[model samples]
Target: MKKLLIILLVLTGTTAIKAQTRTADESAIEKTWARFGNSWRNQNFSDMKDYMTPDCHWINVVGMHWRNLKEVQFAHQAFITAFLKDAKAVDKSSNLRFLTNDVAIMYRVTHIGAFYPPDGIDHGTNKQGDKDNIATIVFVRQNGKWLIASGHNSDVVAQAAASDPVLHMNK
Candidate 1:
């Protein structure tokens, strides 16, 4: 019994150590997201590039796919200049999961202040005067830095009747 207890303690200690290490990685990823949010609000895609991989790909909420860092930067710059110049971005929440020591995925919800749409109408915001989007991002640890490898953003919209859990739960 004493030998078994010692082995269990060692296993528990190893698990604790791994959890601590994962927590640190989670914190680092959160910091990176905060920096990216700041860059977005400031309309500084150049600064945002620092957090992304060179071949990073992004799909915007509207389904536009940017194939590389340069394309992403250029697309954001043009859109911000045209419509979101005065917009504000706030990170609502982030959920991170590690696939491996060097690969992670983050699901982030962001609130964007009211802005003019591409149609020249002030219709970007929702009823709360903020547009909320959920983004799924893939990150890779490269050279001790967490950089975005790819991501896709989608607008959070109201649930339709088909999506109502109460209506489908009985069925």
Candidate 2:
């Protein structure tokens, strides 16, 4: 009985140590996501690529297609032309969950710098929009670096507002 108790105590201690290690890894993912968002707002796509896998996949809600890194960067040029005119991503929040020591998923909400018209018209040359979206990103850490494996963003404001009629009416 004493031997069994000793074995159980060792196992519990090991488990506690492992859990602490995993929490540290999960916390790093938050900083990784922050770097990604900042680089994007700065139009530093090249710098941003370090956060993404070479074959990273982007699922854009725009219904264009599932784009690879290069295509996404090219598309961003257009995005920059429209949104980056005087806009930025602000009020960001990142929530991360670890699938493993090397794999993580993040849910984030952030404001885009300007309001985009549905017809692809650029408005508010210097002014901004109240538009923001929520996104999900999958990150994989390989060879001591974290790379984005997949990501998707969806419009959340209108849907969230619609759910609360009083808030919508106030707006």
The global C-alpha lDDT for each of the candidates, from Candidate 1 onward, is 0.82, 0.73
For candidate 1, write residues 82-142 as lDDT tens digits. 6677777777887888999999999998887767777335664622326788899998989
Q: Residue 85 of model 1: what lDDT?
A: 75
Q: In model 1, what are the clashing residue pairs, if there are any?
A: none
lDDT of 2: 0.73
Each prediction's TM-score versus the true structure: 0.82, 0.75
Query: By summed lDDT, which 10 consecutive residues of candidate 2 come out lowest?
Result: 118-127
What TM-score does prediction 2 earn?
0.75
Worst 10 residues of 1 by lDDT: 120-129
| Model 1 bad stretches (over 4 Å) | 1-6, 119-129, 159-167
Question: Distance from true position, residue 51, model 1, in Å?
Answer: 0.8
Best by lDDT: 1
Per-residue lDDT tens digits for candidate 2, residues 1-171, read: 999999999999999999898777776676777777676667666665767777787776565655678886676656665555456777577788888778888888887755454434565453445677788899998888777888888766665676876865755
**Each prediction's Cα RMSD?**
3.4, 5.3
Model 2: which residue pairs collide?
88-113, 115-129
